[model samples]
Target: MRNNAPSKHVRIVLADDHDLVRSGIKALLSMIEGVEVIAEARDGNELIALVDDLDPDIVMTDISMPGMDGIAAIAEIHARKPGTRMLVLSMYDTVDFVKRAVASGACGYLMKDAPPFELEQAVRSVMATGSYFSPAIAQRLLQPSEPTVDDELTNRQVEILKLIAQGRASKEIAYQLGLSPKTVDVHRARIMERLRLNDIASLTLYAVRKGLIKP
Candidate 1:
């Protein structure tokens, strides 16, 4: 008997709040062979629902949106659908956004202004391996930076910090990380104390400085 197994095409759910942006990206992806836009979402919440319902191979999303922005959605999707890969397509090219996207479990990041070929390449690389950061992003990540208070945080603390910086409430972080709400609060307090930061605004700025989240 001959073994016959069909290869899977890359199925992507593209999310961007702007209809024109989504349409343009959809058009680009349509031009690439073996790639399919399985669905489209205007916000992170809708993206999550579509991912749960469709189980696409990749989720291509923008970083900023009206509700449940991309970083939070990336974290949630990573937790809920471990097998689904995330590709961030955004206009922001700062190191802060790149680091936060990676930390939040995005498998790839590409600038919106990149050539269409680069977009196709990023999707292929992510699906083939486990991750792909565009050339510009890779170069930025390689740049040296001064150490800061974030260097003092434990890995778990950093995890919680990124979510907090993304504006997730303690209760929401608790649910996402499978920890108690009180535990999340404790971590938040500890994070504040370690960095000598008194308010969420301060912590958010610290996160940006440390390349933990977008400014």
Candidate 2:
């Protein structure tokens, strides 16, 4: 353990649901003398509470957790505690996931399977400066997957979104799509649910954002 503290210790708040995972990280980080685990949270809500209550210097988080997911957690944490540095440790090593994590304001991204030494290095790097990307994340950044335009939405969802954008009434959409109005409403609700949109206006905005409709 290195005496890396600057008078006041650098505290970390860890958020993960699984007891084993959180325990593992706490154990590992506990070995580093200068770093302190000031708070532990089992979910995003608790994580936010820890941020407000403890105000730890670093937020070390898992990308997946119960209640609010890690991506949302990181976004929310950064929004609330703008100065806290987020170090993301996840099992997912995909380029898309890493990009999304960093875009959500994570300062460090490391896969759980990376060597313990690398994890320690990443933590120190992020704590000392701005950010850290594990070796795998760095490689993925250089060799990123091509930008994909493929629709992740279901066929029914796309149909609903397009019909809504085309200024079609629910009944009209139902008739054209050969679905009951009830089913169309269901589809509409699901479309909003899937896209995280609010109302018809927002749906239209999403359609324009995705180039499914002209602005």
Candidate 3:
């Protein structure tokens, strides 16, 4: 248990598109001592703006949002405020989503259905050690990396391919992954060539068939 210093409370900003979900999470967070929910955001854009204005110590956010999406916002926030830690609270349990959140610089990831005790534990763990993950996620991370697509595509390429299949432009992918547009383009070209895909449609189809994205 982390005993926060008397003068320093853990300030947090909560972000989730659903009002009820955000309210429930806020209520739960309010139960923890030495923690404060300074503000709330309904979407990733709003979360980004709030973070810019409030500069909270931690950002607790859901992965999916209507505009900008949580992963993109996390990446952007990491770029702008490297010191502000990101903690993800989401229902998405897939390893892909977990990997993406971590790659975007989130220090913690908790399942929404996790026990209430884990909430405060996660907050304290993040503040103390700079990281926490749901037990299931941690286990998955420890297990051997699951084979994705084909053996030819590197992990980074597979990540970029997932974004591209989701209709993200190269510039957006670059921003999300902290790569230059030229680098993203080069990767995209390589992916296309390696997969024998000539167009975005074919690539998207390939991604779907390979379980990279839902149809």
Candidate 4:
């Protein structure tokens, strides 16, 4: 992974749906030493595609992108390229999102509204340690209980969701449980429907709330 400029090089990929968000991040990253934006994606699918093409060392992604979503993006990228480091920056403050992002292989999770210095420090922390969570995210993760809609899902549904939070693909989850993929998907759909979670990010949030995973 190589940044765009030769003089300063820390290749980075930016993935978010909003044009303005991408533009703003790109501007900020350009000023950082040894951190450069090599590629950008407007959605999850595009993010995946860009990784295949550009192979950036670090991926700064939003949690709720269209097409595939950030959690899925993290899992996919990790499964395919375990060496690449990931950082999730999102607006949602839910513990579930933070836990799932780290579980899916994102080394850092920061809220989109974090101070620029916090964001920069997070990136640097992950670059140095291979993992980091903001103090807010860390506190939420350490707490034992947080209000969530998990009561809507049955115990079985909770188990299935735990696997998902662990970055298990539907196929792998089915295989592990000895259930048909379709059946697994049905449970998954039910879990999502009950929790009002439309994407992996939300699902992760749900699992985190239930202590199925950690941030």
Candidate 5:
């Protein structure tokens, strides 16, 4: 909803390597109600530092940033501040890139070429519902596929796995799920054992393959 109230508006820090891209997105967002681009970063490293400092409601970033990739930055930011939402705004729309971005804790993914209205809608959707995927990306996730490790996971394990894939630390997951940190760790261990996932990257890939995330 468009609103004059500061609390109702979404505050965002945008990140992209190209100065022109950042400026163009900032301008587009400026025209939308209830959306404000509060700061900008030219690379993922700078974006991470800015996010830590600014603590905006959302971080909108390009995937192919310099100094550090956007996916890594998203994971880092999510680990540090799970409350801040992440959106990937990039030219790349491939399934692999989309999967990695969402696996790393991004709440939304939009191609840079999306209509201005779609961008606005994505920002609002993610802010309101905790996640959003472009229609194209969503369709890819719905395609039929062979059963995988996910089928072996219990509902609670799948829930924890998604959060883990989204880069929330065990303690943060514990708080969100109303479980102790130790319990979260136990679940995580069991998940990894069941899925034969040795690390976070493996778990993230599993999440992507299972269609639990964007890819």
Candidate 6:
């Protein structure tokens, strides 16, 4: 039993490499009242261009694409249009992938195989509440997590730690992750403080022990 209001128009731009996948998703979206499939893109680069041109209300996208990838595109789109809601429609559900997508500014994460009903629910939820995550994803995100002893680092901090362990300088890491150099440095300092490690050498050794990086 449910009570609902009349649906307002929701313009969506979909991006995926596969034609079949995009067609199926577009068909599903079409069934949901008030949802319009305004544009389609085959890759991140094309998606960025479409988003820049159409300015859709939501961007439903996949994680892996031929050129530029969805995470990088989502980051760029979010930077330019913070008002646009990003909903990731991908098959990857690993913690790393989920964390990276979220860090890159996707407010919603729904698996491609999710029940068709869940798709409608996700769309309505994001439009109403400003965010949505599949039950499994939300569970994984809420679960306790830590890569090292001492204290827990945030997903962003752990991401930075791995890069630092790989000997990536702050500027380079910042560029790759779409963050400022100062933000990377701040995360580095916090990671070291939380782990009680004083130097890059120790941090790198810890990362290796934690299997964050290969020796």
lDDT of 3 at 90: 83
State the lDDT of candidate 6 residue by residue for 78-126, as single tens digits.
9999999999998877666677788889999999989898888888888
Q: What are the per-residue Cα lDDT tens digits for candidate 4 across 1-215?
A: 22223333568999988899989888877776678788999877889889988888789999766446787788899999999989988877777667667768888888788777776676677777787788888888887744443336665686688788878898998998898899999998988787777998888886665545556
All-Cα superposition RMSD per candidate: 6.7, 10.2, 5.7, 8.1, 9.7, 7.3
lDDT of 3 by residue, 1-215 (tens): 24444335999999998899999999988888888999999888999999999999999999777656688789999999999999999886766667778888899999999998899889888888889998988987776765445466877998899899899998999999999999999999999998888999999998766545556
> Which candidate number would show the highest TM-score if scored against the true structure?
3
List ranges where model 4 is wrong by over 4 Å. 1-8, 146-215
- Over 36-77, each residue of candidate 2 has an lDDT whose tens digit, in order, gives 788899887889888988888899988666555576678888
Q: Candidate 3: misplaced stretches above 4 Å?
A: 1-7, 146-215
Whole-model Cα lDDT of every candidate shown, in order: 0.85, 0.78, 0.86, 0.78, 0.81, 0.85
TM-score of each prediction: 0.69, 0.68, 0.70, 0.68, 0.64, 0.67
| Candidate topping lDDT | 3
Query: Over all chains combined, what TM-score does candidate 3 have?
Result: 0.70
Question: Sorted by TM-score, highest first, which candidate order results?
Answer: 3, 1, 2, 4, 6, 5
Q: What is the lDDT of candidate 2?
A: 0.78
In model 4, residue pairs whose N, Cα or C atoms come closer than 3 Å (at least 3 residues apart or on different chains), thus clashing, are 96-205, 99-215
- TM accuracy, model 1: 0.69
Residues 20-41, model 5: lDDT tens digits: 8899899988877778899999
What's the lDDT for candidate 6?
A: 0.85
Which window of 10 residues has the lowest lDDT sum in candidate 3? 1-10
List where candidate 6 sits over 4 angstroms from the true fold.
Answer: 1-6, 144-215
Worst 10 residues of 5 by lDDT: 1-10
